[model samples]
Target: MWSWVLHRITGVAIFFFLLVHILDTALVRVSPEAYNAVIGTYQTPIMGLGEVALVGAIVFHAFNGLRIILIDFWSKGTKYQKVMFYVVIALWVITMLGFTPRHLINVFSH
Candidate 1:
């Protein structure tokens, strides 16, 4: 189903971001110069777009994952899977539109 496919895709995307984030933090322990260099690369336009995509993926995966948890834990939630699906979609759209441009500008301006 579409939902299963999307959930897997978003989950993978979030995991990838988490890996990069951990690696970036690890660079601080390696050397401040190395960490700064890595940080500097984030200012580029391409990385800025990546940041936007990362945010969208995290938001979507987190919200939908929570919905899945509710369905598993609550009897009433199972009855509303369709409604929750729409809620997840709307939340994703709102978050992407609301955050992406601001984040892109901040990343690029730095």
Candidate 2:
């Protein structure tokens, strides 16, 4: 249902983020000055917020992925799939709440 959709979406988002990360890291070997210029844009407040979204996506994707594994490997897992979905959501919310404020403070304070 919704979890399936979200898992796919988050997985795609994470994949793209990793692709960009690899590309950016590779840029340093190609041209240090160009790489530095590219990374400088990430210092902006907008990129700071993007980092928050990236973290959120990674957290949700990781938790939901474990839930999927449980459903696949644990015999009783299917019986509790709905509950596990809720648990994943609860964990995601708690994690984001703990992370967002501290990160925002650091991002804005800079």
Candidate that scores best on TM-score: 2
Residues 1-110, candidate 2, lDDT per residue (tens digit)?
99999989999999999999999999999999999999999988999999999999999999999999999999999999999999999999999999999999998998
Q: What lDDT does the true structure give each of the candidates?
A: 0.87, 0.95
Off by over 4 Å in 2: none
CA lDDT, candidate 1, residue 83: 92
| Weakest ten-residue segment in model 2 by summed lDDT | 101-110
Q: How far is candidate 1 from the true structure (C-alpha RMSD, Å)?
A: 1.5
TM-score, per-candidate, Cα-based: 0.89, 0.97
Give the worst 10-residue stretch by lDDT in candidate 1. 101-110
Model 1: per-residue lDDT, tens digit, 84-104?
A: 989999999998889977887
